[model samples]
Target: MIDDDAVGGTRSQTDVVIGGIKQMLTSGALVPGSRLPIEKDLATQLGVSRGSLREGVRALATLGVLETRQGDGTYVTALDPGNLLSPLGFLADLQQPAHAADLLAVRRILETESVALAATRLSETELAELEAILAAVDDSLQADAEMDLESFIDADTRFHRTIARASGNPPLAAVIDTLVGRTFRARLWRAISHRGSVRETQAEHRAILDELVRRDSERARIRMAVHLLGVEEFSAAHADEDPEAS
Candidate 1:
């Protein structure tokens, strides 16, 4: 079909431009912060039309590989792992509610590793900070029937975020940050609907924190994994109970 041919031609041209830029980067001819040659010049160099080159540049920009400065030119980004992996969060966010468990599974894997690293790396001050967060969480729990769901959720998120930062790996922390945001609404709903779950989750947090304080990396990892698994199970069981909840 003519439309198919047109689509194929566009794809081919984009691929050519992408390949050309990649070659330049790999060869160190286009290092981070290096401005791309003017579009016309670059198109001529790659033997591609300007339109194709622009499309390739836009794609790379979306992936955080390139940045277009206003009134300036496109340049290579710092190419940090966090920046490059950020697009993964966008994709994860797009997943259907039926796939919530899949996202939790991934979070479990990453957060388990992060907790393990934090167990060994967290300083005494950081441990104290975590303890303080747990204390606030407990206070909220003790409020019982009067518990503020939003307050407890805030403390819960801060607890996890603190541990993620203690892991000393920005990329891991960044991924966890995205996952936490994506699941926030679901988690809040769960806590509001099932008040008993708040106590259980706080207990799990205490156990995980104890392991971290003892510098028991393996136990911390296991505790984190177990805690996340419980959350995933709860979410899965109740996902079908309310189709519009998430």
Candidate 2:
């Protein structure tokens, strides 16, 4: 019985319902963990059909802004910007090969700043942990004559994540975390397919770590930028040759 016009009307109503909920959040009338009014009552209040209201609620839930409990109710989430924005990882994963360079450019911008901040803010214990991570990376490299791609990638991710955490900004760390997650798979593939890249990347990581340990914020920032840019260049070159690799 649902015609095209009916579907269009429902979509519009869904948007209105979404807007109303956003406004409530903005006005602080609906804080984190606040249970929404029952579905029927909320639909009536928003002057929307239950179907439209449900669609909007489902969308919000998917974005991590809301959570629904069976037999309980939907409630606003903790509203952590990090949680809400995690879907960016999916977008990053879906990016076409042509967009690889663009993604790396963003990583360079964020990670340069993060490394600079980490140089100044990282404590002795944190520095020690980073050293251990790199040491493990080295050990993994020696584990096999060829190269242990999986182990290296794990250590690589841990190294960057530790630095991000050391930067002392939760939001920035969260963003960098997502970017790293999105790109690490491609990075691993690039390393596996290209000879000498593994060693080169390990050297670069060591240099960046040295700068961080020296507490030279500017040097750490520059080294980090250079390291990421090298990866970007490698990806660009290979992507042109094999557009379907990643």
Candidate 3:
């Protein structure tokens, strides 16, 4: 639960400015791409000192709610999900390895549904594009005795990103991308320490593509679940072995 003072109760002058701006935003008085009132005007309106209002504006700017231009005044941002939810990646990065399973579990729930949606939505051209991405993965796998880890990870990111975007939900795709990107270090460690992981991942990707090709949402969902679950289990089993986990 959030602290009572944090949500309500006695507040600081900066909080007043933040709350005032939030009220404007929620009541449709302020909108995306709209310029904010000048600092003196806004400070007077909010009944706060200019310093407090400036601090509040800085806080919102950090949260992707507003932006300041060089010559132009401050303006509301487009409020894109990718920008709004970027902090999720920061939180994910702070999780200890013990919490990796929990993080991946959430991802599994979101991405299974994402893939199911993508199955029916992906265009023929998009399907071919996904195939090409997998072919790149194959090339990375066969590149040398030591797999080209950078190339392989790049392909892995693209494969999941393509499917997530094809789900036709920008917010969902953004969340999935945040989760996937944060877990990438763990995935890299798994591939390096566990032989045959590359091959196993390759097979799983093929299975998902097959289901997508058939436009079978349920089967695609199941395949995606199994694939993510494997990662969760692997992380749980090997967390102690990962120096990065510490």
Best by TM-score: 3
Per-residue lDDT tens digits for candidate 3, residues 1-246, read 122354465888778888888888999989999999999998888877899889999999998999999799999999999998888887677766667778878989999999999999999988998999998777766776456655666777889899999999999999999866836554545534445577788889999999999999999999999998998787777665653533
Candidate 1: regions farther than 4 A off = 1-10, 143-146, 182-192
lDDT of 2 by residue, 65-179 (tens): 8999999999999988679868878766776666777887898899999999999999999999999988877877787655766666777788998999899888998888876
Which residue pairs clash in candidate 3?
A: none
lDDT of 3 at 176: 90
Ranking by lDDT: 3, 2, 1
TM-score, cand. 1 vs. native: 0.82
Global lDDT of model 1: 0.80
- Clashing pairs for model 2 are none
TM-score of each: 0.82, 0.86, 0.89
Top model number, lDDT: 3
The lDDT, on a scale of 0 to 1, for candidate 2 is 0.81
Please list the C-alpha lDDT of all candidates, in the order they appear.
0.80, 0.81, 0.83
Between candidates 1 and 3, name the one with more favorable lDDT.
Answer: 3
Q: Rank the candidates by TM-score, best first.
A: 3, 2, 1
lDDT of 1 by residue, 1-246 (tens): 012333456557777777788889999999999999999999888777899889989999988999999999999999887778777666455655566677778889999999999999998999999999988877766666556666767777788889998999988998888765635544434533564666777889999999998999999999999999987777666555543453
